[model samples]
Target: MLAEERMAIILEIINEQKAVKLSQLCEMLDASISTVRRDINSLADMGKIVKVHGGAMALDDNFSFIEHNVEEKLALFTEEKIAIAKYAASLIEYGDFVYIDAGTTTEKMIDFIPQKDVSFVTNGFTHAKKLAQRGFKVYIPGGEVKFVTEAIIGAECVMTLKSYNFTKCFIGANGISVSAGFSTPDVREARVKTAAIDGSRKAYVLSDHSKFDKITSATFIPLNRATIITDKLLDKKYTEYTSVKEVL
Candidate 1:
């Protein structure tokens, strides 16, 4: 098959599977492993997909593929995410009900959350556990656990989230684009995110500069739907919609 044909098929598979391994791609395309690697490399260069250790993932502009891996995610933009999280944590008040979405940035916020009378709801197993262990009134939306990200998502999670009304929600995205809006790789997780946004009175998206101008499949919400809390280094192109907050 032609390179273009192979690339098109690769994109199609990524859309359906959310991720694809190098070996699997070679088998599906009837191409040599080296050829598939070249295709993946080319796609990564074009920003069409993100190359992971053993495979590639759909390029979700709001969040990087790195964000899906717990350890690597925690290391990336560590200082910046921590700063953003601290700022978001400051917005929470005692006795408030808050919903925290899944992402490394939102995870950082958990540590900075002040010890107070607050109820927290989440679809992220890690975040839920951390908050629950920290003495916060934490509620976990029961659902299937996506092992790749440790995110709980599905119909059950969405249903559970819909029953609660949070005073504020701090959401995270895989990618954010003016045109594509906020997106995540997993469609199920996107549904959970939408539910969280709908369940909250006010929604704030916590993202670092790296998340800007990225377009991921499965948009959960439009960029205009929520207030964005991000670092000032964000691309100037996003200045119009983003509430850029400098992390001192």
Candidate 2:
């Protein structure tokens, strides 16, 4: 595509979502980082956009937000997600009270998890249903569903988490930055994830390698907060600061 055409598409996406990440733009435009960077720089110079840490923001936007629904997320990093989920599932033992956070990865964990004396508490509608179908004990919080991710989150969700404790919690994140920490796109969902992490004795974050170095809009958990289970941990800094287990 022409540089002008690519820039116009980038503007459309950023304006629609208030922001667009470089990784996402690369996928959308089928362009390289260098090409996307050049387009972004040109747009910023023309005052058509504003450059941010890992992406660009709309000129008319007051804040930046880039998010995806369940369908969009389910397709990316399929192999890595499966490996991470498999590793996370291995940590579960009999009679353990587990908390499963909502995400494409954490949702897959239910499939690999053993059918032992395990009970689950979750904020995901899809997760709850899947766990039930798999004949596992499942508890769901009472909250308004966030249709964007098919996850439940609100004050009620937080309240439900307060009453239950978990032996281990497996969660997901949109971004994991050493400085900014684990984050998602929405603040409401972040609260649920924070509560889950706080309530668990052993908390594990299930993420792909792509999540590393990215910083999303909402900050939920700090770096070194939870042991991360991923397909690969390329950065030595992650291990220097906290525990990161590689599955691939």
Candidate 3:
């Protein structure tokens, strides 16, 4: 096939799958790895898609609309996220008060939270509901709900968070970079996460390796403030500023 025809097929695949790994694309197109890489790079430069490590993801405008599309996002890295969540949950003792941030990775941590006398604070409506149902002392911050991420944010939420201190905070970010620190797509959510980190004694960032080296708008917190808990594939630079625990 011509280069344009192969590139067109690649775009169609990414649009249908939302994400495609480099190796998979090469196999699908019956092309050399180098040729496929060039196609991905060219397409990325053209603003047709976003290139992630080892793969490319379709540029969906509603990327932050996670609440309405939890299933789709969850399927992206099911096992890696589960491993990270399990490792993070292990850090929480039975009586520890924890702050959980809003994101798909943080939501997975809910499954690992043991049924104990733990005080859990959150800005995520779905997380708050699940934790409350699980019989933990869950507090949902008072604020306007952002429909995109189904997270409660605003001045009221920040004020409510100030009332309680936490033993640990498990925050999630849309992107993590050595240069940019931690970031999120929405400014309001970033504010909420910043408050959570400040209110906790020890902060833990739970994200998959996919988030590493990526950058998004709105800086939430500095990399120095928290220990990063992520998959083993994270870049070495992340280890420079904070303690990193790689979940196998």
Candidate 4:
């Protein structure tokens, strides 16, 4: 395709979605990665689109930050959380060693997790208790518990995660952005989430569609580092970066 044609299509996509990842552009244009990247650079240089860390955004696109405590978050997306949690739980298999992150959605997963020969490690105090009650072997790292989120954080927890190689991990994010990746409000908690993802063979970010396009204080992992499982995906461009499963 001609450079002019590709650039025009790219601009139209950005305007429609408010942002576009380079990978998405490459796929949509049926062009090579290098070609798409060069096109993005040219567009950025001409002041037609704003280039970000891993993607381009419309000039008027806004990046906002906000955080809510666990209780408040739990009340916001109740049904979506259940559906997302149920599907996530279905992915677990017997003998799988899993790391479960602390969040309202992930908490719901504990109930749906099938009765099997599976083991779990978690930073959420409530998550640990729930798993143990179900007769599953559960481990909790030694760390200072953050009151607002009720999850364990700090270097100690990170160190503990480093020793385990989990088969699968379910994580939570405060925000999911193509440009900024997966983010959380606290740097310490982000460190814990990063460690878990790095130590696991496979990682999944459990979030509702409400988290999309938002950014937070600290980014734990990049957009491509893990698959996202959400209740709904408003923007399909996210699939250009990594795998996304919409349980709805």
Candidate 5:
């Protein structure tokens, strides 16, 4: 397996087992002790795990959305999010109508988009304001506002999303896995994301590498529904499930 693939499995194992011995990681990844050590070190630097003397420990549960607000999350992976968002914005051509999902990473995209005639539709309160301030044509669906996420989510949002067919969609998710697909902790937001993907001709999931191999509360899209754009393509195995592009 590739280093990226090995790292992903290592994370999955650590998350499942809580703590694992170095020898166990080597046996599971089917690699040498030196190789496993290197992978553990890398994941540690990313703060994805805790490195013990002879093994690694999982970070506190990162699969929940209720724990952190957008303001806090924007600071978590700024560099990675910026890189992935820039690539997602680059895919938007003039005259294209795009749906930008409510997310910390997805919201950063507004700063990087070139001044062009592309229109935007969003459920994020912050995202809509940022896009409007940048002088882009922006639309917001009618729905009940969820203050925690600052997003419009409900039956109304889904209704508005269905009326317009988008050229492309830039989405954000709480977690993702081949088995569970794209997911978030809120079911209402999941409905909005699902509608956005279905309404767009092309769909791109923008997330940092930290999101891979994780499953959250609700599934929004299957792996095949959207192309994955991330800071790193850890596992080539991801390509077997869907299209994945690494920006950093």
Candidate 6:
């Protein structure tokens, strides 16, 4: 095939799938890896697509700078959040040291978590309270609480995470992208999330379909670092970068 023909097919595949691996593009175009890489570079330079490690993704125009309060977020995606939360909660086992991040979905998870033997550490003030009320041993970090999300964020929160090695952690994200990975609007909050994920043996990011293709101010985790539990996955290509579980 001519270079133009191959490039056009590449663009079509990425646009359709939202993202694609370099190897897949090469196989589809019947071109060498170098040839596909060059075409991807050209497309990236043209601002038609974003180049990610091992692949390319459709350019995302949705960038979130502001974070809505918990009440506002609670009203959106309620059903989907509950489904994802329930599935996340089921992953917790007896005697597990779980870290639950602050967000509407993670908060819902507290409701479904039935393990009474598990201990919890959280940066979310509300999550900590809810977990305690549910008869679980809950520990909250000391830090400046962000009023909008009611989440503890700062150096103290990050330091607190360092002392405990959790068996599992459920985290929340403002955005998830092939290029930007898992991101949130606040840098301080991102730091706490980073610490939590780093200190845990396993990490899961709970999100809804609306979070996909979105970018935020700071990225706390890479795509491969955690499994994603969502309402639905619109892009099959994301599975190539990370493990994605769709609850609905």
- Estimated TM-score for each candidate: 0.72, 0.75, 0.71, 0.76, 0.74, 0.77
Please give, for residues 1-248, the per-residue lDDT of candidate 6 as tens digits.
78888888889999888767789888887889999999999998998887765677777678666799998999999999999999999999988999999999999998899856999999989999898888889999998989999999999889989999999999999999876789888889888999999999999999999999897767788899999999999999999999999999
What is candidate 5's local distance difference test score?
Answer: 0.87
TM-score of model number 2:
0.75
Against the unseen true structure, what C-alpha lDDT does each candidate score? 0.81, 0.86, 0.82, 0.89, 0.87, 0.90
Candidate whose TM-score is highest: 6
Q: Which stretch of 10 consecutive residues in model 6 shows the poorest summed lDDT?
A: 52-61
Instruction: Please report the TM-score between candidate 1 and the true structure.
Output: 0.72
User: What local lDDT does model 6 show for residue 90?
Assistant: 95
- Runs in model 1 lying further than 4 Å from the true structure: 1-67
The TM-score obtained by model 4 is: 0.76
Ordered from best to worst TM-score, the candidate numbers read 6, 4, 2, 5, 1, 3
After superposing candidate 2, which stretches have Cα over 4 Å from the reference? 1-64
**Candidate 6 stretches greater than 4 Å from native:** 1-60
Candidate 1, 195-223: lDDT as tens digits: 99998888998888777777555678877
**Per-residue CA lDDT of candidate 2, range 39-132, in tens?**
9999999988777656776664223367888899999999999999988998999999999998899998988998899999988889999999
Cα RMSD (angstroms) for every candidate in the order listed: 8.7, 11.0, 12.0, 7.7, 11.9, 7.3
Error of 4 at 64 (Å): 4.2
Model 3 / residue 70 / CA error / Å: 3.3
Position 143, candidate 6: lDDT: 89
Model 2 lDDT at residue 185: 80
Q: Which ten residues in a row have the lowest lDDT in candidate 2?
A: 56-65
Candidate 3 lDDT by residue in tens digits, 105-206:
888888888777789888889999888888888878899988767789999998888888899999988777764577776777788888888889999998
lDDT accuracy of residue 179 in candidate 6 = 65
RMSD (Cα, Å) of model 6: 7.3
> lDDT tens string, model 4, 101-153?
99899999999999999999999999999999999999999999998898999
**Model 4 deviation from the true structure expressed as Cα RMSD, one decimal place:** 7.7
Model 6 residue 233 CA deviation in Å: 0.5
